[model samples]
Target: MDYYLLPIIAIVLGFLFLILAFYLALSNARRITKLGFINLILIAVVAIACGLLLMFVFTGDLANFV
Candidate 1:
């Protein structure tokens, strides 16, 4: 019900942002210099951190799930 909506929405948005970041990284890889690859990794790390933080805030039981 209503309780599930926030978590569901957060998950969907998290995935969308991750996908967008990955696609942007791929696109940049083709156009930018070799150093740009580092940016891609940074972006991925940040996305993962954000996703985990969101899950932690919403679920409050990260250890049990992961």
Candidate 2:
């Protein structure tokens, strides 16, 4: 139970941070230069993709544990 809790918490926190970062980027888009904004967008996309991949890879193991 404790082990499961930690991973669940981590997943929630990761999603929270992702959403916060995205909102921050969007809010600052007008102030930042176009190039910088585009870079930020790209980074966000890559990060999301990597996160999803990780989740998929781990889900099998996690399911067995649960």
Candidate 3:
């Protein structure tokens, strides 16, 4: 359990970042500049990548138990 803590925290943070990116995108929908768009895309990409990577790692670890 303790060994999984880091990946869990990372997954949670990745979701949080995704939510934050969504909120920011919606809130700034009317006047998003190029820089803002790029930032939003970067945040989304990082969040998705982090979430997916950790999920794969978690699943792979679980597979070893079965």
Clashing pairs in 2: none
Please tell me which predicted candidate would have the highest TM-score against the true structure.
3
**Model 2 regions more than 4 Å off:** 1-30, 60-66
Backbone clashes for every candidate come to 0, 0, 0
Candidates in order have lDDT scores of 0.60, 0.59, 0.67
Model 3 Cα lDDT, one tens digit per residue, 1-66: 564565566666767766766776678776666677677667766766776676677678754653
Report the C-alpha lDDT of model 2 over 1-66, residue by residue, as the tens digit.
Answer: 644355455555556655655776679766667666556566656665655655655575655554
Ranking by TM-score: 3, 2, 1
- Order the candidate numbers by lDDT, best to worst: 3, 1, 2
TM-score of 2: 0.48
Global local distance difference test of model 3:
0.67
- Give candidate 1 regions above 4 Å deviation: 1-32, 61-66
Q: How do all models score by TM-score?
A: 0.45, 0.48, 0.49
Query: Candidate 2, after superposition: displacement of residue 21 in Å?
Result: 7.7
Between 2 and 3, whose lDDT is larger? Answer: 3
